[model samples]
Target: MIDQANKLREMIRKKAETEKKTKHQIKVYSIVSGKGGVGKTNFSVNLAIKFQQMGKRVLILDADIGMSNANILMGIETPRTLLDLLKDDLILKDIIAKGPYKVDLISGGADLFYLEKLDDKKQHEILSNLAELDEYDILIIDNGAGISKQSLTFTILADEIILVTTPEPTALTDAYRVLKAVSTYELKNKIKVVINQVPDMDTGDYAYNKLFKTSEQFLKIDLEKLGYIFSDIRVNKAIMEQLPITIINPNALASTNISQIAEAILGDKEYNYNVSNLKQFKNKLIRLFG
Candidate 1:
């Protein structure tokens, strides 16, 4: 009887280890830019789809506050936004609007009144509920232009941040300023750069190298180059028609770049990132904001 019990105990321990290894928490990524019109929202919408393509459940949060318009780019309209979930006590699954492919989206409210009214406790409650859903493997938040306290909060809480910029000098300068500001936060060190709307590979390389070199030399932070997107006519056409470029023109240059970026983001499955549970996510939110 004693030997049989020992064998069962070993089997249970191994099963627990295997289960823990397979369990992955929802990875939160905040997509931000120094200014608008840099294709930030469009990138966020498509990237979420790419993650879904990789067999991972993805959620896109249109947290752009006053300028939130991700649904417009994806040609999606929802009667309910995230505020409705918090106010009406709706489940996360119910608030999620069906998005492209396997991805889901959380519509943004016109105004941030409900978000602003949320105290630390209230915010924690919402996040705890969100984490409990476990229906998504990742959450991508598309923030508004420039830097604000609200955007900063999202960046600080994120596991990774992708700052999009263009080849223009002014845009790069503004991106550097944003980078400098965000560097003060202790947990925001894993920031990456994405040069968007480039006309060619040369332009893309120049934009990325300039930002990477400047960030290293001046900001004293090693900003990794995530990937670059070529400016394609298909992208403009899709945006004008309120459609995602990838859905409209799968073979377009921009679409190919999106796929590559997604692959690069998922390059390694070895490193175990912090898997914050629902309660831990709530506690961290309260602690960070409190």
Candidate 2:
């Protein structure tokens, strides 16, 4: 009887381990830029699609506050947004909209601005609601251009941050500034760079090397080159039609680059799953602001 009980317990333990391994742990990635018009929203929307294509459940959180427009790129509209959740006390599931590739979306609209003035009770309520969403494998938060208190909060709380910038000198300067601002938080999240709208491979290489070396030398932090998007006309064409470039033209250079970026990002999946990512992010947000 003792030996039989031991064998049964071993089987139960193995089953539990397998279940844990297969369970999805949500990873929050904040996609930000130093200035506007660097294709940050476009990257966020399409990158979420790429992750979804890899068989992971992905959600795009358009946390751009007053400039929330990721839905425009996804070709969907959310009648109910994060604002409705805060104001109407609606559950998160009700506010979520299905976008391209069937990825989930939560449009923050202008209502996200209220995050600054959230009372303790409201903060807890919001965090609690967010914690309830464990079905997603990834959450890509498309933050507004330029740094603000609200945007900074989201950036600091993410599991990783992708700083998008162009090859222009001004864009590089702004990207460096974004890195500087993030460094103030003594952040642990991995910071990656995506050189968007580059005219050629040389331009992309120059941009990445500039940003990478600058961050490493001055900020004392290393930045990863996630990948770069070519200056492809298909990107704009897809934007006009309200479709992700990946779906509109998977063969497009921009689409292919994004796929490579997704693969690079997922290359480190051998690590143990972090099941408490959302909870930890929530706690930090509340503790710091609540």
Candidate 3:
């Protein structure tokens, strides 16, 4: 698998060298759930670490509205948040918090003013600054669960959405509900599923098939599989310690699954999420939230 990955990466490199210098593709993925307590943020944080390991400049935008905590999960301290940008006119570069593995983090900071009263001029200022900081290769939005307006907005605008759920009955039911909600947004192909906390590959396959078959039969949408994370004690331990499990215990079952998932995503390059500039990407988000 390592050799295959190396050859694939080499092919990508040669292809890139021969092609003209177009803008770097910045992929945005919204990791969401039907309800809370399903390990969505944990997956996002570890996934960021995996992407960083793969040599991609990864950023975690804890845009989960009232429940944002990518910094907390990574044991990071950012002196600033989105509020700093709105209130004190802080640049996007200034408010960004650095997390483990040097993954850049941006707090949602969705205070009343940020949620409802941020003026267009200030929005443009922050976005323009963000456009200048486009060194990142991927931005993952750890969005809040369910059909909240903010969550839906983030998922809809993202280049792709990864809907997470466990194998429990209630969780699977809610996962389906979230998928139904995302269907309203009409980015069917961009939606993927991640079955978390499975006991084994059989359980994972069953969970994924349950949802996949349901979505196909009822919603008529073909959801792709991003892969699954097994139930691992190291996951809970790392969460309590506020560290990425992959960093703390790479040999853990969940970490191994996440690593493979990240590699699979990197190897699939059929989609290009190029933002002409960072300001342009900001405009897309602003349109969703403004």
Candidate 4:
């Protein structure tokens, strides 16, 4: 028993040393929703593409688990996925596939059901590999919809959480429930809302008002409006072709809206996107998950 324990300690030390060598800070942003089919996957892919266009090394992790679709929307065939990394001893760099705008993509393949049952050693391995992805300027996690413990963990673990919803009443109600749950954990401040599929700015504002007012009154959370994506048929056409709207129609309204979101996220003073503090930011994340 003593020999086994000593061996485990040495293995853990080696893993830690390997992680320190790649010391970098990855801005983890998780795009999630209360319900599905609100264009969550589309938003995540486009945002990552837009960021890449802005000269950032981006990695998009499809965290939708059972219903992963980022790769399908982007129209890329991935040989390996997050599942492969979790199931094997592969490093993050080994599994990442290149996507549009040179973005790195990792699919959270359908076999993630096994992830929930992973033992402590496996869990530590996964986290250690993720921690080594510090080479990326940003790691966008497109999480599964609804309020599962798994999804919530992703949201809370991210540096920022963007909630996507349509203007429909049901969508608004579901988003509110998500915000409320986030508030219970004091995560309301880190949350941002993006209104998708709106008819016009007036309708978008109308939808935002419903969520804005309720959050102000009930949850006391000031939700930031990350911007709105206008309804566009071109989006559907682009998706059918497995292309990002930014690539197919960069001038389109939806693409423009998503670009603005990328700018806002990059320019936000609170996020400290400056190059000077990149090392500091990385250290903070290390301390966070250490």
Candidate 5:
């Protein structure tokens, strides 16, 4: 028994050493919309691909609950999903799929009814697994619309919250609602806006300025403008092909705009797009899973 105890202590020490050597590379960014059909999923997919292009290891989590569309946008068929991870006792590596630009994708399938009933044990396990995903340079959580508890929780926990909206009044109202809800957590510093599907820069600026003023005056939220993507038909074509616009048509206006937005995001010291430590985490994961 004494020998066994000594072995266990050595094992614990080795594990601690591995974790200490494992650099932190994961940055969770939750992309949410005020309304549906605002191209939120498209933006999320392209942003993930852009990060991958910049040589960062990225994992895109489709956190949209019952109506996940990341798989559709990426044009890949996911055999397993977040449901399998939560329900079937499956490992993280088994459920993650590879997409365009080498982006890792995980689908949030229709089995999200259990989210509300999650017990402390399940919540703890989920968060533990999430923290262990140090292999990813960034984890993008594409959340569902209309201020659900899951969406709010994701936004609150994320290192950054990207609110996407169009020039439509309804979309703007919904964006404000989400901003206000997130402000309740005092996370205004982490919030940023992306005006999608706008006709031009002037219109996008108008929409962003309106939200910025309202958030400052009413919600006391200091929102930053990340940039905008134009309303381009090529986005729809790329979605139909199950490819990111950056891969399908990199020279398209929307694609160029998306890349610029990505650059702006990386410019922020808080976002941390550097990939020097991703290789270390990947090596650790390979060892642990092998």
Candidate 6:
């Protein structure tokens, strides 16, 4: 009887450990672009909404410096931003504003640029605050266009990166530049490309292949084509109306394309997420700053 009881206890403990390892983990994806006006923020916001519709808790961190426009697209006002946390002694919970479909938004803006200059104490405070966001299933970081220290830091630390680009020649060259910078860091995070504003599937493929082949040949970096967004006029209308295309017209070609990308992301089973991802990411950022 004693032996049987001990055996049962051991089995239960092992089962609990196994379940813990198999549980879903929060994912962090940084949406970045090499040039402005590539619809990076638009894609980030809509992707967040799609993830929310699919029953995932999503948060969009508008880390676009002075270009923190995700709130504008979400039709919400950011009364407080990440700056408030450092300057006003506010907590992360206090600055997080709710957007459409209950998505969380944090306007980091230029405030994130100051993070690297913070002392260890302030960094710890910010880290503690970020810990409260563990309930979120996904974090979409909308980085500023072009390369910057802040953007590259987030890109390197992110679990995955979505590089948005257009079919323009300038856009493709700039996109390749961003990949080159990432290659210099020797980070192995998965980088996915999203060709936005494409007139057709061939245009999208051409854009992806340009970046794909260039990065593969020059930087030896493998790229995945997440998907593309068509040039839908409804996208413009939705932007002017302060709503995401997905919310205003889910049937729009652009909206459907974003939904497909979201589906593909969730369907990918190879992502290994650790519960300590946020903490690890924070530590890595701090080290980079150091």
Q: Scored by CA lDDT, what does every candidate get?
A: 0.78, 0.82, 0.78, 0.80, 0.79, 0.83
Task: For model 6, give the 10-residue run with minimal summed lDDT.
Answer: 270-279
Residue lDDT tens for model 3, 76-96: 886677667666646767788
lDDT of 2 at 256: 98
Question: What is the Cα-based lDDT of residue 196 in candidate 1?
Answer: 94
Off by over 4 Å in 1: 1-24, 86-89, 110-113, 119-125, 269-271, 274-279, 288-290
What is candidate 5's lDDT per residue for 1-290, written digit by digit as tens?
Answer: 99999999999999986666466656778899999989998999999999888878899988898888888888777888655766667767878887756898887676543534567666545544544676677889899987887788665556678899999999999999999888887654547889999998899989999998888788867788999899999988888777889999999999999999999988777655523253443443233222
Total clashing residue pairs per candidate? 0, 0, 2, 0, 1, 1
lDDT for model 1 = 0.78
Model 5 stretches astray by more than 4 angstroms: 1-13, 21-23, 86-89, 112-126, 185-187, 273-290
The CA lDDT at 54 in model 3 is 88
lDDT by residue (tens digit), candidate 2, 22-67: 4536787889999999999999989988899998898888888878
lDDT of 1 by residue, 183-258 (tens): 7555476577899999888998988888778777767466888888988888989999988888888889999999
Give the worst 10-residue stretch by lDDT in candidate 5: 281-290
Ranking by lDDT: 6, 2, 4, 5, 3, 1
Question: Which one wins on lDDT?
Answer: 6
Cα-based lDDT at residue 125, candidate 4: 64
Candidate 4's C-alpha lDDT?
0.80
Candidate 2 residue 206 C-alpha distance from true site, Å: 1.1
What's the true lDDT of residue 169 in model 3? 88
lDDT of 4 by residue, 1-290 (tens): 99999999999999987656555556778788989989999999999999999988898888787788788888887788655776556887888887756988887677544555667667556556655665678888898998876677766567778999999999999999999988887754757899999999999999998999889888856789999999999999999898999999999989999999999988899775522124444354344333
The all-Cα superposition gives candidate 1 an RMSD in Å to the true structure of 5.1
Pairs of residues clashing in candidate 1: none
Structural similarity to truth (TM-score) of each candidate: 0.85, 0.86, 0.86, 0.84, 0.84, 0.87
